[model samples]
Target: MTFRPISIFLSPNTEKDDVQLASKLLFKPWLWKKGKEILKFEEKFKKYLGARYAFSFNSGRSSLIAILEAMDIKKGDEVLLQGFTCNAAVNPILAKEAKPIFVDVDETINMNPEDLKTKITKNSKIVMIQHTFGWPAKIEEIKKITQESGLYLIEDCAHSLGAKYLPSQISKKLRRAKKLCGTFSDAAFFSFGRDKIISCVYGGMAVTNNKKIGENLKEFQKKMNYPSNFWIIQQLLHPVLMNYLILPFYNFLKLGRIFLALFLNLRLLSKSVVRIENRGELPSYFPQKLPNALTLLALNQFKKIERFNQHRQDIAKLYKENLEKRFILPFAREDKNREPIFMRYPLLVDDSDKILTKFKRRGIYLDDAWRKSPIVPPATDLKKIGYIQGSCCEAEKIAKHILNLPTHINISPNQAQKIIKLLLNAQ
Candidate 1:
């Protein structure tokens, strides 16, 4: 029997078409940033998300930074956010010269409204709500608190592009309308990165119903330079690497782990990777515009979102039937309209180290990489990142115990069985 390693990413059948689309466009160098592609993609995306306006960025960090800037969040202002989230969500708060006040998360691995109410200070000007792993936070409750307190709400929809957080018990009349994650907040952002549900190597978008935020975002973008040709080429080369080398080749991942260890030990990737940026604090200035290459890649992937998301939903159902009760899992509330996208199926266990070791031995990928620290990638100071010690007890516990399985379209039935087998055997 072959040592089958279940990888989370499925090599897209559209990889050839993606490469072809990129090839035809590469000859038109002037079209790099000047083309209708970016604007067209933005228009389609805004309609898809039910947002009134959209602005593309080079990365999620850039989008969030722009949001803070647009909101005029300045020195001494506090931006309250969940402690148990990626550093990309927190770095922008630090970058804007404003202080980040860490809030705790509930079982959803998202912002806890109760904890949020307690953490708000007189200086608190914004609330950053993240739908971690596409598990919707108690949005209606959080929104009410932010509204009553006069705080701006910014949703981090990086992991939850298609997720719906239906109306909570606000009113029977309002409960019928289902709200997407990005639409519910004052402003929101999405990431199309290597591992995100909408993979395009690297790209992000800032969206808003607020005319002011939309206007400010366009103004800020006007001054930004387009990504260089070399950078574009690298993005163009992703399909081959992802589809051919990374997803199907178990040996590549095994060797990649060794390479990663060497890279970390030799300080290759950049020390502040844990913080989602190279420096613990963001630079005074960074590239903020979306590259044409990423946009082109994103456009190709955008067409297939429905099919892939449906597959992800199917995989989540299978996992629930097999792995429920044996592990702590995420689900929608009483509202039938609310459904998690299941970007990654999260489970809290006794010892992640032991489980990670067991899965590794079998070439089965359980996500140990998502939460090395509360800010992820291990060996980072929560204090430096603006999180106070002993403030988020639940987040801290969830961080240590949480692990996830990939629910991408590429995972087959046999691979899921192996994952279930491994998870059930846990002591």
Candidate 2:
């Protein structure tokens, strides 16, 4: 049984053009670390989202660290965040010597505003909301809660780039004004990791509309050094290496898998989640500036942002319109105001691991978008990461049942239909 692997990330997210760009940049060693590409990307990204200021970072987690530092988060200050998220989101709080208050998530796989209200304390200074899997959380309700409590709102827009939130009730002047997820909060951060809305191998940006906060964020950015040229080359080599060395032989006698392991072992390919991050510890390289090389790849992806998002939306619509009635869908298509740019269409199944195995055998790869834990990489110790068992019951349950289907730009309508048929049969 030989066929091309429909990977969740490796090949599906890598375009021919992306590989070409990386290949060209690999030879231009002078442009590898410092250049105007960084400034250009930041300018274009801020303008795209209507933000006043934007600062780039080494990763999404790095961006969060800068946000926390800029806001003066210190020992004992509580940062409220929901469960069913990556430790990448939580570790930044710990890095600042602040306490992380875990809030439960509603069906949107985002923070439950009701549960959020219960967790606020006098020490709680910030409320961080994750737009999980490109679905906007109940931002309007949460915004009101944060405002009444006098807590800063930070939107984790790692999974959501073009996703929007349309409120049901609005003033006549602002009626029907659907807002992008990152803009509604005091500050927001975006990821350009391999599996995100856009891929630059690894990168992030922190943006704010507030004059003072933006200035503070810039100061923090100025203090950090650019990533080493060696690190920059490693990131640039990712897509190029994957396309040529690994993806082609991935399923052929498991040769691709072997090549991938070999590269990772030889230190040529980088792992998205590093060893220290899973332990709720910050890496030495964090909070650094986003190098110029990766921005070339990111800026290229930015050009196709609309096309990428629309493709995901269309695939999500197809899934919503066709999946079996028994399957629990992520969003209500009937709510015209509640638009979700589905990074991956999530379904709650009886046994996620079992279903994933069946799909993998058929050359379709599926897995839980966030790992099967309150904090991702499931190996993370709950006590070490400030989560207790049964803390967020809904998120814990969802972690066991969540199965993500690919909705990236590479998936075709026909392929989606076939995937739907496979899912129905698997049931």
Candidate 3:
């Protein structure tokens, strides 16, 4: 018997305007004006994030590498990060020939500041914090610790773009709430991949308050050549294929990942381009140029971010109202500063494998997003630092037990309810 598949996460690219704008890039090739469009998008993203400088890159991973490179972190230096995160977040540190010191996560699935504080050593140079699955990390405590230790704090806001952190009491009474997550850190990165809330086909951005960092990032971006024209054409066609033929087929046949992996391996796939990393050394500069088409597409989508965020928020509410009683749902911060536009609705469960298996039997798709540990040295005392050691126990628990119900803008409330019911009854 066929069963309805409820995916954990889905792209929120349902708007007609988004579709039309994306099509324009495919049908019409106007490279000359793309730069201006990119700049416009950067400005809007910066404004939205309350960051001073926004630099777009080819992908979120590339942006992470660019930010680390721009910061001048080098070999033997240690960058503290959550143990549970995508390889993209961890690989860049290794690419720099720097050590990635893993830290444990708190209930929020972000870096535990307590764990972070313990990991700080003389060799520690940067603290890379991830806002995993759209839940905001405790930036206030992290900011304080990083400041006192003189360590550069880099917020990995890849999962939580529209998410906001309220000002601390001191900041609120004093009217001096520090910048948002991306702005709070020395640098932060965001992704605009196909599955992200903001789908620019494939793109990423790094934001910072330092003008010098922005300049350095731009210089590095300029050195990297733009993506090939053929690749740009492929990106332009991704949304059309994904929304119409591909997604429908996957949904109907319950072959989302099988088809996705096959599609990704195709030579024509726009995101297939790989940048060679110089082993055991940090490159002094980036050797790539952000694709003009990516920049233009990202810029155009920036205008509609508010609407996109709202949709995510609505979905989050539905998840909370429906799923929280049965699962460990995330709670909003007491501080009223900034509410999160959830990137993914994560939950903690007692038995992940069992839950996942049950869901799979029903053709419900709950992704175990970013289940690996950062490829850091084995003796980094990651567990001691509370960076849940042994391959992201927190992330694994969430991946196995937690279900990412379909919460995209395109999914109807009834669809979401159906997913919640399946999960609720599964237990």
> Which has the greatest TM-score?
2
Question: lDDT at 178 for candidate 2?
Answer: 88
Worst 10 residues of 3 by lDDT: 371-380
Who wins the lDDT comparison? 2
- Between candidates 1 and 2, which one is better according to lDDT? 2
Which stretches of candidate 1 lie above 4 Å from their native place? 1-5, 9-16, 19-31, 168-175, 246-248, 252-279, 283-285, 332-337
Off by over 4 Å in 2: 1-3, 168-174
TM-score of 1: 0.89
lDDT of each: 0.75, 0.87, 0.67
lDDT of 2 by residue, 1-427 (tens): 4345776677456788989999999999888777899999999988889999999998998899999998989899999999998888989899999999999999878999999999998999999999899989889899999999999999999999999888767688987888888999999999999989998988999999989899999999999998877788789889988888787777788888888899889888888887887788987878899988888899889898899989998988888888848698866446667667888888888887777888878767766446588788777777898998898999998888788888998788888888888888887
Please rank every candidate by TM-score, starting with the best.
Answer: 2, 1, 3
lDDT of 1 by residue, 198-283 (tens): 76666789999999988998887787777666556555555544443444444554654554455445533222233435245664
Per-residue accuracy of model 3 over 1-427 as CA lDDT, tens digit each: 3232456543455456665666777766766224666777778787788778887876787788888888888889999988666555665677777887777777767788887877789999999888776667888888899999998888888777777676565544666453455767888988887667577767788888888888888787766766667667777777665555555666565575556567667744444223322122323323244566667667666667777778778887888888777888755334455577677776666765676777777666665343322322222233422344354455445444444455566767777777778778877
In order, how many clashes per candidate? Answer: 1, 2, 13
Give the least accurate 10-residue stretch of model 1, judged by summed lDDT. Answer: 267-276
